[model samples]
Target: MFKTTVTPRFGDIDGLKHANNIAIAIWFEQARNPVFRLFTPDLDLSYENWKLIMARTEYDYVGEMFYGHDVEIISYISRIGNSSFVVTQEAWQNGTKGAIGRSTIVHYDFLNKKSEPIPDDIRKKLEEHLQNEDNSCK
Candidate 1:
């Protein structure tokens, strides 16, 4: 699994003084930089070079997140398919799980405008961080 830390900013706080739901979503996406690097080593955004696209995303809030605390974001591949993979992530703050999320990313050919199968080399790398049924990397 890949882990990242996010420091909540004051602007992220809601009227209730808790981190806003939107902030969690942004944090989750930002924490995915490592995974994005797997497909684009240089983090290039050129249409021709970018090979992955976000197909879906969902999040469930389990607890409140307060500002001035660090949130640990853990991410791992939960499922791998021919043309797509699911990334499962968790947000933990103060030893409590604040949120859980899943993102489906598809490998696609921009020129062809169609989804493509993931390359073997990349697949092997992703397998290295694959999460097992018990929520541990294999």
Candidate 2:
């Protein structure tokens, strides 16, 4: 379930008088923990078992967000690859899309401590849940 709550923190704001970009990233990270939990408790286990790691991340700010405002962070899987998966996250305020972010995670091996391919079970879960409305059309 996607939970919605008001983010109240004075330090999250920056000199621009709005939520800093880093704060947005932290919010999205907090919001997406459920997805990882749903797939596996020891998310790190997969890297050792299959060799996956978080490869890249990007965020795009759409509207100004301030502290004390109710922020709703929606988390969803976007794309699943043979060795990686992309997670898409969006932050909203009063039903308006305020910011969007995506993270690409790859499988890695702890012994080697390097990037590797994603595991089968996790990939299957990502493929199953990453579906969106538009996916049905395709």
Candidate 3:
């Protein structure tokens, strides 16, 4: 599991003073840095090292978020497949759930344009953070 705190900038809020929908997606992406770093130790952009491709992403806004403080995002791996994994993220602000998101990331080879199986070391690290909706800690 991983958690990250981000301070909302003035531009992150909408006219209604709530964090914009797009902001949630960006925040969740930031929260996944730990997992990303684990897979790419040197942060290389080479095709061989850039193995993850975003397959899908969605979000639900349960509450509103405003500026002036930090929003904490919690990330968990929900599923692991031969070439893909599901990431679940929760956005919390002011002690309440503001939004939740899910994203599908596929291990892929950009050069050949095909999915690749996740390596054992990466899979094991991801497994350490697994928590599906059914058994997630609220």
Candidate 4:
């Protein structure tokens, strides 16, 4: 699994004084940079070079994340398919899991405007980060 830390900004706090749900989503996306690199080594954003597209995303809030605390984000491949894969991530704060999320990303040919199978080499790289059943925030 890949791990990263995000320092919650003061602006991220909501009226309730805890990090807003939207902030968690943005954090999760930012933590995905490593996985994105597997497909686009240079991290290019040009449509002609970008090969991945987000198909769906969902998040479940399990605990409150307060500002002024660092949030640990754990990310790993949960499922791999021919043309798409699922990235599973967790947000932890103060030793408690704050949220769980899954994002479905598809490999595509922008010129063709159709989904394409992930390259074998890229698939193998993703497998290396596959989350084991026992993996979890401690």
lDDT, candidate 4, at 73 = 96
The CA lDDT of each predicted structure is: 0.91, 0.72, 0.89, 0.93
Clashing pairs in 1: none
lDDT of 2 by residue, 82-117 (tens): 666777877887777788888887655668776656
- Scored by lDDT, model 3 comes in at 0.89
Please identify which of the two predictions, 1 or 2, would achieve the higher TM-score against the true structure. 1
Q: List, residue by residue over 1-138, the lDDT tens digit for candidate 3.
A: 898999999999999999999988999988988878767877687977787899999999999899998999989999999989999999988788899899999988998999999999999999999997666445
Q: Candidate 2: lDDT of 24?
A: 92
Stretches of candidate 2 exceeding 4 Å from the true structure? 1-6, 42-52, 132-138
Per-candidate TM-score against the hidden true structure = 0.95, 0.78, 0.94, 0.96
Q: Could you tell me the TM-score of candidate 4? A: 0.96
Residue-wise C-alpha lDDT for candidate 1, range 44-100, written one tens digit per residue = 999899999999999999888999989999999999999999999899998898889
Q: Cα miss at 118, model 1 (Å)?
A: 0.4
Residue-level error in angstroms, candidate 1, position 117: 0.2
